[model samples]
Target: MDQSMASDLIGDLISCGNIDHAMVDGNKRPFICLELEDVSGNKLRNITLWSDYAQQLNDALGDRQNLGHVVIILQFMKHKIYKRKPAVSSMFGVTKLFINADIPDTHTFTKLLIENRGSEGDDHHVTHLTTFSSYSIKNDFLNNLQKVTINDIRDIVKPMSCVVVATVKKIEREADWWYLACVKCNHAAKQESVSEKDEYGVVVKKRSIFRCTNK
Candidate 1:
C-alpha cells in the first residue's frame, strides 16, 4: 500500500458487454466487461467495472453502443489480472472515472474518433455527463517507507520489513505445470491406472479415472 504515483489509463472504449453479476469476496456484485483500444498505440486491452461503478457506467451508457466516440480516463487506477487478461480498473474509495471531459487530450481524441467514424457521424454521443462525488486520493500521506531491492530480500534477515520498488524488465515463458485437482475437496487427484473390459467382455485396455473422496 506504499504506492503513491497513481497509474493513468486513457483509451477509447471499443466494446462493452451488459452489466453482469459476479461473486466477489463471497458477495454478489455487478460488473461489466469492457474492451478498450489505445488511440495512438493501437493496442487493445480489457477493463472491468465492478459494484456501484459498474451500475453507474451502464446507466450512463443507456442504449449507446459506439462508446468509441468517448474517451475514458481512469485516475488512480490499479492493475490486475482478471481471467488471465491484463486489466486496468478503478481502486475502491480512491479512483475516479472521467468521460468526455473538456481536457485537451479528450478534445483531440474526440476529433480523431469523429474522423474515424467517417460520414456516418456521431448519433450515439450521449449528452449526459457521468460523475461521482465520493472519490478521494489515498496517497495523500508523506511516503516514509524504506525502499529495498530484490537482492536485499535474502540479505535482510527476518523480523525486518521494507518495501521493494522494481520494474518488470521481462516476462519469460515458463513450462506448463498444472496438478490435477479433486472435484469435491480440490485436492490433488491421485494418478492410477485400472483395467476395463470392452463390449466383447475381453480385457480391452487400461483407463484413468479421477475419484473425489468427498463425493
Candidate 2:
C-alpha cells in the first residue's frame, strides 16, 4: 500500500506496542523492536527495521526521546513461530516498516496545549501538555531533572493522544497479564491480560482497579 494509504489505515492496521528494546548495531544502524499486541490480544508481535530504515528511525529518536507517540507506516508479512517465547526473528515477520519522523509544529503544539489546559478536570482529557512542554525544552534542562522524574514525565507523555495524556505511574505484572497504576491514586488497574510467564514459572496476577493518586 502507498504511504498515504497506510497512514489512513493506521488506526485499523497498525497495532500499538511497547518498546522492549532499542538497539544500535555495530554498523550504527538503529532498530526499534516493539512488543505490539492487537485488539484481540491473541499474540504479541514484533516490528523491526533494517538498513537505511534503521538510520531514519535513529534520527527520529534523536529528535524525540520517546517513540510512543510517533506515528509510522509499516508493511507487515506473517511468519510462523515454531517455539514458545519466540525469538525476535520469530516474533517480527519479514516486512518493511516505514516512518516519517517530523516533529509537530509550534501551532500544533499550541493547540494541544490549549485543549489540555481547557480540559483540566475532565476524565476524557488525555493530553499531557506539561510533559510536552518539558520535552520541548533543551536537553540541558532535562539533565538537571532527576532520572526518576524524567521517567515519570516520559511515562505521562508517551501514551497520550492529541486530546488526552494518560500518565502511567506504576505497572504490575500478574499471571499472564499486566496492569497500569492510576496516576491519580497509584492504584493498579487491569489494562491487559497476557499469557507470558516469568522464568520462575509463577503466574502473574494483574490488578483490575486504578484510581488517581491525588485522591
Candidate 3:
C-alpha cells in the first residue's frame, strides 16, 4: 500500500522520528534507524527501514534540510533491549512525503489550537495536539526560512528534549561552568556546565539546563 495514503491510520500523527544512524549494505542499498514513540508513554520504538524503501528514505533525508510533515506507517514486530532498556521494533517506513506541504499557512491549525486551549475533555489529546501544532509551526518557520542546520533540527525534535531559540545577550563563564542570560527574562539560573573530556575520547553530559525567557 502507498504509505502516504495510510497517513490517517497513523494515530495522533504529531511527530517524526529522528534518523540517528543510516547505513548501506554491501550491495549499495540503504537502511535507516529511527527513534519513534507514541502517545501512550509505553515505550520508544526503534524502526528499521529495509531495501529500496530504505534507499529512498536515505536520499529524502539527505542533509535533513526539509523539515516537512512526515507520515509513517509501521507494523510492530517485537521488543528487544538495547543498552538495558526496553524498545519496540518496527519495519516498513517512509519519509519526506510532504516536503512540499505548505506550513506557513498554518492559520487554521493555530486557530484550532487556540479554540482547544480551554478544552476540558482528554488532557492527553489537548497536550499532544497543542504540542504538535506548536512544533509544526516552528518546524515550518525554520525549514522554509532555511535558518537552522540539520543538527539544529535534530536537537529540536529529539524525544522528550526541550528546545528554545533566542538571542544570546550575555554569557558568564566560571572555572567549571558557564551561564547564559535570557534576553527577555534576565533569569540567572539558566546555567550550563562544561564536561571534561576523557582520554579515551568519551564525553558524558547531562540533560539540558532550564531557561525561562518569561516572554
Candidate 4:
C-alpha cells in the first residue's frame, strides 16, 4: 500500500521490529514504536503509530512474546509528508487497533498464515484460547521473507533464519558442515580478518575476528 494513502490502512499486517519503549524527554511520557510490515513481508516503515496509539496497541498485546503471532489491524491511520517523503502516522485517538482478535478478518488471516506452513490450523480449542502458536513459526518466516523456498538458499543473502519445508535429498560431507555460533545466542557467528600494524605502518600480527555491533 502507498504510504500516502488518503484513507485508513486496514490489512493483513504484522510488526517487523521489536516494540520500543522509552520516555519522551520533555514530558516523560512512555511510547512504543511498532515497525510494521504487510503479509508479503513488505515493510511499511513510513507508518508511524503516534505515542497515544502506540501505547494502545502496546497495552493490548500484553505479553510481548505474543508479538510473534500478532496480526495488527489499524482502523483509521493518517498520512503526511515528513522530511519531503510520504509518511503515515496515527490520528491521535481516532485510530482503532486490533491484535489477533476473534473477528472474521482475524480468522481469515490466521487461517492463511497457518496454511502457508503446510499445516492444519483448525484447532477450535487452541484458536478460541488465542494460543496462536499456529503463526509463531510461520510469522517468523514472514518476518524475513514473503515466501519459503529451499532453492533460495543459493542466493547470497543476509544472515537470517526462517522455516522451510524441503526433502533432505542428499548431505554434502566432503567438507565441514558445522559452523561456529555465538555462545550466548543461537545466531551464527560471522568471521572477519583482522590485521595489526606497527607504529611505522609495518604489518605486525593478523587474527580472525568476531564481533557484535550492538555490544
Candidate 5:
C-alpha cells in the first residue's frame, strides 16, 4: 500500500521467458515474465514486467545470452495476485530496480554462487532456457543430477547437459489433445474427419483437422 511498507527482494534471475504481446486497454503492450531466486535463503518468486518496464527490460537483455545470471535488487516491491497466480511485482513510481550491482545483498549472492558453483570466468551470467519445452526435452536424460534452483543455474548454458534445480509453477496440458498421425505411417496419425456422430446421434461436420500433408 505504501512505499515504506513494501518489501525488498534481492535475488538472481533464474528463468526469463520471451517478451510477449498482450492486449491491454484496447491496445497492444509488451510484458516479460521472469523467475528469481534468493541465494541466501533459496527462495523463489515469480516476477512480471508490464508496459514500459517490460519493453525496457527486453531491449536491455534481449540479446544477452546470460539472462539467468543477472542479479536483481527489487526495491519497494509488493506482492499481488496476477495471471491467476501470486507474484511479486514492481510498484510503479515507487519501486526501483538495481541490476548486478555491488550492494550488500548482491555481494552475498555472488559469494554463495562462487562458493557453491565456483567461478567460470566471464561466462558466469545466468543461462536462460527460453522455453520450458526445450528445457524438459533437453534435460530428460539427466538422472541423479543435483537439483538447483533457476537462480542457481546462472552458468548453465543452453542444451543444458548439467542439471539445475527449479520450482515448477504450472504444468500446461490438455486432456485427449494430441497430434494426429498419418494412418499409413502410424507416426502420429492425422485424419480429416468428414463427419462424426454427436451426443444426440446427429451428424455434424467441422473444419478439417490439421494432418500431415505428405500422408
Candidate 6:
C-alpha cells in the first residue's frame, strides 16, 4: 500500500525515544519519536506523537519495556514528513493508539513480526527514554504539578525547575539564537586569539575556541 494511504500500523516498536520540544506560537511544545516495523514491510517506520498524544503514549507504556518489543497499533493517524523524512504523527482528536493491546490485530501482527523479523542490529536510531508517565505538559508540567507563568517566577523563594509558556519579544543580544558549547560539559565556550601567523606579507591571528576537555 502507498505510505500515505496506510493509516494503521502494527508491529514491534523498536524503541521509544526522548520527549522533544518544538516551537509553537512562540511557546515550546513537547513531542516524541518512535520506530516500529509494520506487518506489510520488514523495515522500521518512524513515528511521532505530539502534545497530549505523546504524554498518552508515555502514560500507556508504564513498566512495559521490561516485557520486550511492544506491538503498537496506531489507528486513524496521519503520515507526514518530520525533519525531512517520512514519518507518522497523531491526529489530535481523531487518532487512537493501542499499545500491546490484547486484540486480534495485535496477535496476528505479533506472529508475523516474530516470524519475519531479523536481527535488530540494523536499526539506526537508538533513543533514550526520558520518563514513563502519562503526564501531559498541557495539563501540567509534572504529574499533578502545575506549570508557572512568566509573571509567577518572581515570588519563588527556593530553587526549582519550572515549565512556562512565553513569547520572545526580543532577544537579549542580536544573533544569540545559536552558539557553540562543549559537547561533554554543555558549557558555552568563547573564542580567543591563540597565535599570530605570518601568511605571506600580512600577519594573521589564529583564533581558538571551545575545545573544552574538562581538564
Across 144-201, the per-residue lDDT of candidate 4 in tens digits comes to 6667466766583776766566679889989898877777765577778899999999
TM-score of 3: 0.27
| Candidate 1 Cα errors over 4 Å, as ranges | 1-6, 65-68, 112-215
RMSD of 4: 17.2
RMSD of each: 22.1, 23.2, 21.3, 17.2, 17.6, 16.1
Better of 1 and 5 by lDDT: 5
Q: Cα lDDT of all candidates, in order?
A: 0.64, 0.38, 0.41, 0.58, 0.66, 0.68
Which ranges in model 2 have alpha carbons more than 4 Å from their true place? 1-31, 36-44, 66-68, 82-94, 100-215
User: lDDT score, residue 84, model 2?
Assistant: 46
Q: TM-score of predicted model 6? A: 0.49
Model 5 vs truth, CA RMSD: 17.6
Q: By summed lDDT, which 10 consecutive residues of candidate 6 come out lowest?
A: 118-127
Q: Is candidate 2 or candidate 6 better by lDDT?
A: 6
Best candidate (score: lDDT)? 6
The alpha-carbon deviation from the true structure for residue 135 of candidate 5, after best TM-score superposition, in angstroms, is 15
lDDT tens digits by residue: candidate 3, 1-215: 22323221121223333333333354443344544323342323334445554555556555554333333344443445554654433344433222223454233333343355443223322111122223476677667754565467655543443345777787767565646667665555454565656788678654556556443
Predicted candidate 5 versus true structure: per-residue lDDT over 1-215, tens digit per residue: 34246787777676667777767679886767777766554756567666666666667676777444677777777777654666776666777777777778888778887676666325645445353233464465565356776666676665446644457797668666567767665456455666677999888866667576655
What is candidate 6's CA lDDT for residue 124?
31
Cα lDDT of model 6 by residue, 61-80, tens digit: 67544546577788887877
Model 1: per-residue lDDT, tens digit, 1-215? 22344677777765666777756789887766666556554754556677777787788777785543657777787777655666666667787877768899887766776676553335543233221211112232224445556876777655555555579897767965677789666757777788889898888899888865545
**Lowest lDDT 10-residue stretch of candidate 3:** 124-133
Using TM-score as the measure, name the better of candidate 2 and candidate 6. Answer: 6
Q: What TM-score against the true fold does each predicted structure earn?
A: 0.49, 0.26, 0.27, 0.42, 0.49, 0.49
